[model samples]
Target: MSFEDKESPIEVDVQSLDEPIDIKAEKKLIHKFDYRLVPFFCVSYFFSSLDRSNIGNAKVAGMATDLNMTDAQFSNIASVLYATYIPFMVPGVWFMRRFARPKYYLGTMIIAWSLVTIFTIFVKSYGAMIVVRLLIGLCEGSYLSCMSVIATDYYFPHELARRSAYYFVASSFSGSFGGLIATGITAIKSGKLESWKYLYLIEGLLSLAAGIWVFIFFPDSPHVLTVTETEKKIQADRDRRKAVYMGDTKFSKPELWSALDWRLAVSIVIQFCQDICLYGFSTFLPVILKSGLGFNKMEAQYLTVPIYFLAGGLYLVQAEISDRLRKRGPVLMFGTSIAIIGYIILLAVKSSAVKYFACYLICFTLYLGTGLNEIWLASNTAPAFKRGTSISLNLSLGNVAGAVSPQVYRDAPDYTLGHAFTLGCLVVCLFAVALQSWGYKQKNKLHQEILESGVDNRTKSRKHGDDDPSFKFLT
Candidate 1:
């Protein structure tokens, strides 16, 4: 069979391999895709984040008291939401990629969680809260990881980080926005429901609207559509920069058996470390400032706005630079280094002014390691199943931190132990990143030797993804 006949359903059309440049057309297509899709992803992710972290907003707005939750029970409320997150990551990606278009599946999932967020208004007890949280997890599973894959369809590999940064920024914006909304929501004295319930009802309605918008308007990737000659050429050309691994439509037993290994474990560790930093900061920062640093409730809420803005802004700058340099390792190292410094300041400093600055530093680097790391793994892996599996594994394992980090607040007030623990996770993550970079260099050398032996194996190896000598590693 010819290569085109055997390629995965989602891959770039082999027919376009030799197509001449169409700089103007490519730019138009990209801008069109960005205009059409990025906003949907941005808004969807913003709602996802607002709902996910709004509990932090709600907790401070008095959900705990309204529901009679103890500190431990409150922590459990945070943790229980991820009860299904880990188990569903891989399957979620696999299922969405196989059966659902990116737009429809994600829109549906967002609406599901938005409704779950609304259900929080009815929680009069801790048991009710736990059930609601667990249901939320089932709705949210693998959405972020799937977003990573969908981005590859819309952007070239080098462009993925900047686009991903937008989604990341939406989350940061959501954090800050959540705080602002909570500040207002808490000031209300005349509401029928509690202040926190208002926070949910409003955010939930907006989220549901965004979901419906995407479901109505989001289009399938152009590569998958061939209704017209002009459209096919435009899309096929766009694929010049698209990820070569579009993934298979479904999983097979052999692919599954061969995909798991130590590298996947390491990727998961890297993800786990990043999430410790993410959930550690995103989930608890406002509360930490209030309880530990002694800011008044509203004072703490408004203060979070600038911190999240700074972080989101900083990530956009970093994403642009990473895409320009095309260097994942250096960016990952630099980001982690900055984050490590932030943790150190939080650990060692006596000045609250400097400590607040350190919080910005942590939020700033939140997207650095994890966002680029997703691009890094996606660029290197191939044969859609392996890529999906590895990304899902990394996300699923890493997200356990989202559940666990909230409870680490056991060291409340000072929170010295929690910060230290997160610091340690980042350090390990950096080491893992370095090892992968080094391993890439070594593998490239071996591929070089094989090429020099006069074996024409490049085309034969496309089925192996990055393992193909024709495919070079980003490292």
Candidate 2:
């Protein structure tokens, strides 16, 4: 059924393929894509991150006490979203891969999750909170996978790290600015709702507005992008070189096997290790600042701004480095090493002031490793289905750490166990990075030997995606 679809053909204008690429037109069209897509994605994701983690903000604002919840129950609230999110991610990506209009599909997802966030305002009991969170997980589990695929639709492999960074950094934006937003909401004198309730109400409405705008304006696919005929031709020429084939939605069994190789296994391991930190530390950052570091409530809410912003800024820097070097593993290795030092400080340092500084070091690789890892997998994988499958698998299995992390951080003020465990996970991530690097090097070597023997690998790559010996993995 996937292959039989007329729309799935890799159609390019024949005449345009013959013409020399219009460099100026290409630049203009890329710029057009940047403006049209990036802002909407960044805003949509900003709220998504905020809604997912704002329970911490709400907890600090007295939601736990008001609802008469225990620490173990609060921990369950943190972990339960992943119970649904992890299982649903693969199917979500499948639905997105088959969906003709991604804008409509994604807009519905955004609207669904935002409605759940608004409903969070009325959760007066633990049961209500768990239900709403589970609903949100179901709605949002596929989001990252869908967005990553949508990115490949418009950008080239080399350009993906920087572009992905643009939206992915919005998680940090939510952490930094969400604190201010939450703090501001607390100041409002609303007799009808608690401060935490206002936090959900305001953030949810803003996300809803963004969803409506996306449904009305976002492009369905690159085919529907508003660009000149000359630009379209240039795009076709570029598509021939892409890891992901534009307009070809068919699932190839060969590509599936290729996607399940050792490289993907290593990538999955790295993602899981990286996410342990992402979910554990990023979600509980406000709590760490308030309870762990002896900061007062308001200070904790506001202090997260600089730390989160610094992390976002640093991830962008590393992304530029990764793009320029055209290497993912080296960047991953470098950033992870720095964060290892940070974690060491966090574990060993006794001074509160020094530990606070160590938090900044930890933030260095917080977003960098996870975001770049996705870009690496996307760039290295082939065809739409394979890329989607690999990403879904990577995220779904990897995000099980999200379920584990909240439990590790069960002890609030003295998070020694959490710090040590996260540091250990970073060590595991480094080992996985080494394995990926070695695996890519060995495969590329074998491909080189095959090419030297005059093998017809390009034809295979063209037909079967990354199975060709001539196609090099982006190491």
lDDT of 2 by residue, 325-415 (tens): 8788998999899889988987787787888898898887899988899888877776667777888899898999988988988887868
The sequence of per-residue lDDT tens digits that candidate 1 reaches over residues 1-475 is 0001112222244456686656676667667667777887788888887887777778888888888888788778888888886788778777777677777888889888888877777877889888988888898887888777666556666666788888888888998899899889878888679898999889988888888888778766645543457656867655433334343435656556545765567667888898888887877877788877778888878899998888889888988888788777778888898899999999998777888889977865686667778777766666556666777777888889988887786676778888999999999988988887887778677677777885654553434555655556666
Off by over 4 Å in 2: 1-19, 188-190, 243-248, 455-463
Q: What TM-score does model 2 achieve against the real structure?
A: 0.92
lDDT of 2: 0.80
Give the number of the best model, judged by TM-score. Answer: 2
TM-scores of all predicted structures: 0.91, 0.92
Q: What are the candidates' C-alpha RMSDs?
A: 3.7, 3.6
Supply candidate 2's per-residue lDDT for 428. 96
Best lDDT goes to which candidate? 2
- Candidate 2 Cα deviation (angstroms), residue 463: 8.0
